[model samples]
Target: MKKLVLFLTVALMALPLKVKADEGMWFLMFIERLNHRDMQKMGLQLTAEEIYSINNNSLKDAIVQFDGGCTAEIISKEGLILTNHHCGYDKIAELSTPQDDILTNGFWAKSKAEERAPKNISVRFFVRMDDVTKRILGVTNPNMTEAEREKAIKAEIAKIEQENNEGGKYTVSVRPFFQGNEYYYFVYQDFEDVRLVGTPPNAIGKFGGDTDNWEWPRHTGDFSLFRVYTDKDGNPAPYSPDNIPMSPKHHLPVATSGIKEGDFSMILGYPGRTNRWMPAQGIEQNVSFAYPAWVEGSRLGMDVMKKYMDQNDEVRLNYASKYASVANYWKNRQGMIDALKAHKTVEKKTKEEKDFNKWANKKENKATYGKVIEDINAYYAATNEKSRHDNYLMTILRTSDMGALPYSLGSAFSQYMEASPEQRAEMKPYLVNGINESYATLALPLEQEMLAKQLQLYATKSTGFDIAPYVKEIGSKSNNDFTAYINNAFANSIFASEEKAMAFLENPNADVLNNDELFKLSSDLIRQYNTVPENVKTLQNDYQKSYRLLVDGLRKANPDKKYYPDANSTLRLTYGKVIDLPRGNKVNDAAENWYTTLQGTIAKHKAGDEEFEVPQRLIDLYNNKDFGTYADENGVLHVNFLTDHDITGGNSGSPVLNGKGELIGLAFDGNIEAMAGDVIYDPKLQRTINVDVRYILFIIDKYAGATNLIEEMTLVK
Candidate 1:
């Protein structure tokens, strides 16, 4: 296969002597061969084996993929887990009620018996990973079409996963890398009985909120604590009274010695996705078309949700996690758009493509490497409008529970209707419970407004493309106004209320669902969103082929440069040092600018302000200088710090380790100056914003007075 040849061609080349330490999300399996020496030179004290060892307890064993989204690390022998507060926001919100609004006031389990377990929360410990590129490539050839090649590779991957899973003892995943030129299978052990131990109040945990999210000199105490439980035999199990805290293979020791400029810092975690290898045309499409629609759609959803949220404490608790999620990405997309344009990223990628094209078109390379850029450019040109249209509809489904009911609940209802009586009996409880849960958190007025506004937004913005047919009909008849139509539909539809829905479940009917106006609207939107013209599918496939070749060609063209695969939620390591950026007229000085102290936090406080309000207790403590031992040598409690370590979305909550593999900080956010870091790493400007470990300790020990938690941890002074 051409892809196989491409993989081999790059593999056969000698490894580069050195690589920029701050730039890569590197695979653990290749660390010794590819990066160990460079890392040692950059002050990494751990051996490669100590960093990632399949044969022994190592740093990898302490890190976990929290809820399949963020990273968390083991901090105690009793399975104490430390992760970003935002990472645990959903579970915290789920466990919150108006009477006991722990999400707003914060929660702490003084004893293990008080720890609350939220349903469906789990953490995955990375066991090991191995490259299977050659095996995956062995099944297909150059003449095979993309579809055929994918089918063949998937079949082999299934076998590989089955073989490694050890009879369901582990969760095994085989993932494609470098645009499918390589493959690797990762093994993990999942613990389902995770329980929340403690969290600071919203005013503390989410101090700066959206206003300071991606900004530097941040003062957010973005950390939460949970504990993992296991069966008596130390095997993963569901929650039980008899279960005990897990004794993890390894746990990071907490470091309170403090940090300074140029101190070694490292992060090991799962970074979700990065399109660093994307072509110039793809970047242009995202910046100019796709992201703008996403930003607008997300903001509409946030506005609708926030209006209801602010009206009642219960509503706020119910929508807290959802609102935070939408708001975060809404800001991120806008920042990405600004950063991409400001950094001239598209122009840079375009220049790189031009250089690559020159090499690819050379006589010896033309037959195999030519046409890559042409196909990529043409594909984006054809799909730009479609991408914009898709995102607009997608945001509605993402934001409005009612907008997604047809797919989520309706699909379950369909399954119930089609099942045999025995199967229906087995599934009825789950189906009924699902409907009850959906309506419990959903405010009818809020859902109606969200769906109507999102549909209106979609109908108005997605011009030149066919809007969802039912939505279009309503919009046209009402001059793009969905208020009346949506109100009438909610008044009549069974899905709008639990009583109406349960009544329908007593005697489910296909005709009732088929003729429902709300159902029709949702069904139409889903259908249109999913259906792609065959010509467009062809273009997408061609784009995939060309993109793969482009990545491969770039590697071949630059054989002297080291290449690391883009992140796809797999465990990876990135290392660097404490770093600072020049701000306005100030020189880049870490001692003055690398970290934000609690004093700065109080300085920014605006009384009664939602995002900037400081808790009275915290303010009093700061005024009294009651920081105790959590303060630095200079007696200031640092809230957050900056590092040159590379990270992305899923890296949130990852442990920032000092040279001795001691936990010093928790990587939470990245500065806005390098929002384009997902596509291009800017060493001078891109920095990982982290919650200092001492701040976490102060919040737990002094602020919350959870000294039991302090006793559990192994603290290094």
Candidate 2:
């Protein structure tokens, strides 16, 4: 059997002694060994055991995976969860009607009964984690192919999960780290009966909107409140009127003592993917092909959705989350492109790879690591040949709702066909409900235009792929006008009408689907889409294998250097100090500070500009300085502050803790200057933009007048 050797503990002597404290997303498990002493020296007052412990309730129990994407932390013993407003955006939108419009006017429950319970909303609490490397590696051999090794590892993981889950009472997953160099299993307890507690209006929750999203000196109060409920026994259960408020094992105390420059700050949350070890060629492909297509397609889709959204409040509410989600990445991709070029990231990676290759070519290491660089480079070279066309097709396939719907519906319908009669009957209501909900959000004119535009882009830009032959024939018959062919297809297709779809569902049959033109188009597109390009997966496997070996080689080469696993949606801890960025080669030291206050927010107020509009109630409070105890010594309510804490996408709602483990802020965004931080960390320019916890309290107590919610929290002065 081939064993996996992980560099879990790197010697302090292996690294430069004077390294900056702002770069890594360190794992909690190694804190005692690797980070505790430095952290204590940097002003961390809590012991490593206090932060993470299996024998007792700790900080980890207070954090959760919010709705599978963002992070949230418990702030009260009754399980009041605080997360980014954008994280709860869709749920609030779903609960909103034209009459209620919670998303526009904001919502605050006066009592427990008044709170709204949205379906499919849940929070996952981390129970425990165990290193499962030996068990997984025990199932594989060096002679096995990549696919075989993967299969063996998966089977072993499933076995481990089955044995550890205690009969589905817990959610267990074994995640790979350092490119499969290590494995660890995390067990979680999920709470399904979560309710919406409160949220500020869009004017506050999304105050700066797209323009101020990854920028500094932001004034957005990007926070929302929810509460977890469970059975009387405090066990996970589905939503029921009988359920009671949960008493969490632990909760973070809110700090109102304020912060100064160079104060210690830390964040712990599940950060999503980061490719810190990516080869130069991968960066080149992302910049040249993948990211550009994603940006263009997302922008195009957003434009179509925006036209409808602007004209109708209901449409706006329905697509608000979708638009925000798309717009975030569109801006992020643009920033990444600009930053990668500006920072010369590819050049940096190439130099590092050269050094790695030189080290690998040494006599003792030659057999195991010598070919890694060559293999990775060749794999990327071959895959990059069709990368452009692949990206264009994939973007259209993913972004254009009209183009993707039939295919999505078809996949479900295909499952229904293979199901037994009893099973088919069981699946009917769900399938019908899905079709209805999907159709309700779609508009024919908007969808038609989107379909036509995306197909045209795909046809013109992508060379290797072909559109459906039937559709192409129809277009050729109509003087090569895709518009006519698509219009006719919509007119004749069952998918274009909910009534027709429902009518078909009353007596579902395979022939009806087989004969449907839209279904044919979907089938054809999927057929071509599934056809694996020659050598794509093979080269991809090569790249992954070589990448793993490259990481291993680096570990061997620099045995003394500290090594933290790349972010893979796992809980991580990063600590740093709050600092102001230099403004054009000099720190902006005009008493402007590294934080923003309500005064600055008022200064930027433009009455009708959507991005700059301040709510009237907020204005009133600011004018009167009625921020209560949430204001600084100067009586100004701080809105946002900058910290050097390392964070990425899924850390959106992570609680920013002070030295004493008190919640001071919520990490939401990263400054544009460090947009390439996912690939390369830039200590001087990188900054984590956080919404000050005081601002959250100000909005909840003063602006929204939801003092009932504030009394539940433990506040430290």
Query: Which candidate achieves the best TM-score against the true structure?
Result: 1
Most accurate candidate by lDDT: 1
Off by over 4 Å in 1: 1-18, 585-591
For model 2, how does the per-residue alpha-carbon lDDT over 1-717 read when each residue is reduced to its tens digit?
000011111111111122468878877878899889998998999999889998888888899989888899999999999999988998999999888999988999989999999879999998888899888888888677788999999999999899989999999999887778788998888899999999999889888888888877688889899999999999999999999999999999999999999998899998876777788888897898767876887788788778988888887887787778878878888899999999998998899899988999999988888999998888767756356555555655655566678878877887888899999899999999999887876667777877766666666655544544654565556554567667887887778878877776776688878877677776666665565556777876776677778887888787777778777777889899988876664332136658888887887788998788898888888888898899888777889988988788889899999999999999888888889978887888889888999999989988878889999999999
Clashing pairs in 1: none
List the global CA lDDT of all models. Answer: 0.87, 0.81
Measured against the true structure, the TM-scores of the candidates, in listed sequence, are 0.96, 0.94
In candidate 2, position 93 carries an lDDT of: 93
The local lDDT score (0 to 100) that residue 280 gets in candidate 2 is 88
Question: What overall lDDT, based on C-alpha atoms, would model 1 receive against the true structure?
Answer: 0.87
* lDDT per residue as tens, model 1, 1-717: 000000001111111113588888899988899888988888889999999999999999999999988999999999999999999988999999999989889998999999999999999999999989999999989788789988999999999999999999999999888788888899999999999999999998888888887887788999899999999999999999899999999999999999998998899998887777777888899998888998999999999999999998888988888888888888888999999999998998899789889999999889878999999898889878987888898899878989878556776777789999999999999988998788888888899999989988999999957788888888999989899999999999878889988888889998888788877888888898888878788987887787778777877878887788887789999999998776855332235888888888888899999899999999999999999898888788888888998888899899999989999999999988889887888888999999999999999999999999999999999
